[model samples]
Target: MRYIAIDVGSTFLKAAQLDVQYLAITNMESIRMPEPLPNENPLVKEWNAIQLLELMQGLIDRQLASCPGCKGIWISTQMHGFIITDEYGVAVTPYISWQDERGLEYADKLGSSYFSALMERVGEEAWRRTGLWEKPGVAAVGLFHMLQQADSGMEIEWEGQGTACPVSMNDIQTLGSKRLCTLGGYLIQSLTGSHVCHFTNAAPTGLVDVRAGEWDIDIVRAVGCQALQFPRIVVGTDIVGHYHSRWGAIPVYPDIGDHQASVLGSLADATNEAIVNMGTAGWISRVSDAYHIGEWELRPYFEGSYLPTITKLPGGRNMAVLVRFIADVGQSIYGTALTEDTLWERLLAEADRAAQYFKTGKGQSSNGQLHVHVGFYGKQTVADKGAIDNIDSDNLQVGGLFAAAMEEIAAIYERNLYVLATAGEAIEQITFTGGVIMKNAFLRDAIAKAVGIEAVMAPACDEVFHGLLRLALVSEGLYASVHETREVLLQAIL
Candidate 1:
C-alpha cells in the first residue's frame, strides 16, 4: 500500500509518496511556506492560516490524483502553532508561529507579582494534569496574550484586511470562537469539517491532560479561557476524516506532532533511542514508558508513553545570530559590508577550523577559552540574557567565538541528558536529525563528545514525514499497532 505523507514545516510544506510494504519513498515534493506577515515587534511572527490550508489541500489533491494506490493521507506538522476560528471554521486571527514571544509582554504587563503567582499556579496545575510545565512557546501563553488583548478591547484582525473583519472578544465568545486549533487541526477542519486535534499536537498546547489524553478544563479556566477553548483530542492513529478523490475516498489520520513524528521516523528503536533535533530550536527527547515530570518538558508518545524533552532556543538560529553580529562588528571595524551568505560560509569554516584546534588542545591555555551563552529563547532580562565571557584579545576572532558557541550548545545537551540519566532513563544510543545537526560534522561530533555517546545519524533526514506514514499505516490496519509497524519497518531496513 502507498501512503501520502505530508509534513507542514515552518519553512516548507512537503509531501511524499511512501510505499508502506517496501518501506520506500517513491516520490516527494516540497514548497516553501507562505511568507509570514511582517510585524513591528521583532519577536512576533504570524502566517496566513487560510492560504496555508488551501495550499495544503491542493498538494493533497494532486498527490491523491497521481498515486492511485494511495490508501490514506497522513499529516505531520510543526507543533505549538495555533489559530482561532468562528462557528463556520473560518480563521478569526493569524496563525501564531511557535517562535512568537508576545506572551512575555503580556506576562510583564500583568506585573511581576501577579504574573509570577499566575505562572506558578498555572505551571503546577498544568504539570499535574498534562505532564507539561507551563512554558513560553506553548499555545497557552499565546492564548493568554490573546485574552489580554481581548480584555483591552483591541481589534484582532486576521491576515489580509477586508479578507475578514476584525473580531472582538465578545464576538468570539458569542460566535463560538473558543477553541484554539493547531495547523493540523485547522487543516482537518477544512478537510473533514471537524475542529479536532490529535493527542500529539494537543500535548504541547499546555491544555491537554497527557495521561488522560483529554483537554483539561481547569487549565483553560486558569488561563481565563472557556472550557471549549481547545480542540477535541484524538489519538495519532485515529482516522479523523477522509478526502474524496477521483480514485475514491482516501482515509486521513489525525495529525501527529512534528517532534514526536521526527523521533519515530528517525529512530529504529524509539524506546531505547534518544534524539537531538536542531532546527529553529534544539531539543533532547528520550522516550519512557512511564510519565515523569522532571526539569525537562514532557510530551505524549504513541500508546500512552511519554517523552522528557529539554528544549533550548539556541539552535541553528543562534548560529545565524552570532554570524550576523560578527558581520556587523566587522562592517563597523573595517568599513566593509559582507554578504550574509559569504559571512555564513566563512564563519562555519572558521568554526570548523577552531573546533579542530580545540580537539587538539590548542585553543585552551589552562585558564579556559571563552564561554558564549546564547539565550535566544526567553525574555530579555539579564537573568535570561546571553553573554560571551573570558575572552582575551587572542581568542576574540570569529573562529574561536563561533567554536565557543558550538561548545556551549553541546554542553547544554550534555547537561539535559544528565537530567534524564538522573531520572533513571538510560539512552542506549544517540540519534541525530534536523538539517543543521545532521550535515555539520563539527557540531555533530561536538555533541557526541559532550554527551559521552556516539551520535548516529538517523536512517533518513525527513523523519517527520516518515513518522506520519507509520501512523497512517497503523490507522489503515496494515499493522496491528504502531509498535508492530515500527518494528517491522525497522527490521526490514536494518
Candidate 2:
C-alpha cells in the first residue's frame, strides 16, 4: 500500500510518498512556507489563510499527479498557531502564527500584558491542566488579546503608538461564534469538511486538558473565549474523512503534531530510548505510558502514550549565531566573504580539528579553557542569555570557539537527560533526528560523548513521513497497534 504524508511546518510545507511494504519514503518535496503578510508591527506574524490553503492544495495536486493510486493521506502540522473560521469553516481572520507576539502588548489601563492578564485570570492550575508553560504566543493568549480588543471597541494595532484602530473589530467580534483550529485542521476541514483535531495538535493550544484529552471548560471560560467552537478531539489514526483527489477519495487522518510525528518516526524504543531532535530549535523527548508533569512539558502521543519533552533548547539557530559572527569577522578583517555552505564547511573543519583537544585526559591548555553557554535564545525561561567564560588569546579563534559552543550544547542535552533520569525514566540509548544532528557529525559525536550512552541516528531524515506511514498501518488495520507497527517497520528497515 502507498500513503501520502504532508507536514505543514512553519518554515516549509513538506510531503512524501510512503511505501508501506518497504517502509520507505520516496518522491519527497518541500516548498518554502508562504511569507507572513507584511505587518507594520514586527511582533505580528500572520499569513493569508486562503492563500495558504491554495498552496496546500497545489502541493497535494502535484503529489497525486506524480504518484497515482495513493491509498491514504496523513498530516502533521506546526502546533500552537490557529485560524478563526466561521460556522461554515470559512476563515474570518488571518492565520495567526505561533511566532506572533501581539499578546505581549499591554491590554489594560493598569499596564498588564495580555499574556500576564490571561495567566492571572486562568491561574497556575491551567498550566497543570494543559501541560504547557505560559507563553505569549499561545492560541488562548492570542484569543484573549482579541477579546480585550473587541470588548473595548478598539482594534489595537501592534504598532508602538498604541492607538485604537477599528480595522479588525468585526473579525474580533466574530470569534465569539467562530471555530478555532490549527492550520492543519483548517486544511482538513477544507479537504474533507471534517471539523475535528487530533489530541496531539489540540494540546498545544493551551485550551485542551492533556490528561482528559478534551477542552478544559474552566480554562476556556477564564480566557473569555467560552463561546468559540473547538473541534472534536480525536485520538490515534482515526480517519476524519476522505479527500476527493483526482486519483480517488483518499482516507484523511486528523493532523498530528509535527514533534510527535517526527519522534514516532524515529523508531525509538519507548522503554529504553530517548529521542533528540535538533533542527532550527531542539527537543529531547521520551515516550511514557503514564503522565508526569514537572520541568518537562507533557504532550499526548500515539496510542495513549505521553511524551515528556524538554523543548526550545538551543540548536542550529544558536550555532548559526557563532557561524555568522565568525563570517563577519573574516569579512571585516581579511576581506573574505564566505557563502553559507562554505562557512559551515570551514566551521565543521575547525570543530573537527578542535575535537582532539576535547578528548578526555586533555588539559585545559589543550582547549584554551573556553566554556560557552549557548542559551542565546533562552531555554525554559526567555530571560536567559548566553555567555562565554574563560576565553583567552589562545582559544579565541573559530576552531576553539565552535568547539566550545558544540560542547556547551551537548552539555545542555546531557543535563536535561539527567533531569529525566531523576524523574525515574531510565533512558538506555539516545536516537538522534532532524537536519542539524544528521548533517553535523562533530555535534553528534559531542552529544554522544556527553550523554555517555549508545546513540544512533534515525534511519531516515524525513521522520514525519515515516511516522505517518506507521499511523497509516494502524489506521488501515494492517497492524493492531503502534507498537506492532513499529516492530514491523523496524524489521523492514533493518
RMSD of each: 3.2, 3.5
Off by over 4 Å in 2: 156-167, 330-336, 357-368, 378-383
Q: Model 1 TM-score?
A: 0.89
Q: Write the per-residue lDDT of candidate 1 for residues 371-468, one digit (tens) a residue.
A: 88877556421225678888775667788888888888877777777776644447767888887887677788887988887679887768886677
> 281, model 1: CA deviation in Å?
0.6
- How accurate locally, in lDDT, is each candidate? 0.75, 0.82
Weakest 10 consecutive residues, lDDT, candidate 1?
376-385
**Tens digit per residue, CA lDDT, model 2, 1-494:** 77888889777898888887777888888999978877887778878787788888787778888877788788898898888887777777778877888888875562798888888888997668898878877788888878887788886542221122123545667655688878889999989988899898899999989999999998899888888888999876778999987688988889999999999899988888889999878889888888888788888998788888888777788898888888888899999998998889988998777766656435356535678877776333321578888876566666778888888888888888877664446789999999888999988998899989989999767888888888887776788887888778888877
Cα-based lDDT at residue 315, candidate 2: 79
Judge candidate 2 against the unseen true structure and give its global Cα lDDT, from 0 to 1: 0.82
* Winner by lDDT: 2
Instruction: Quote each prediction's TM-score.
Output: 0.89, 0.92
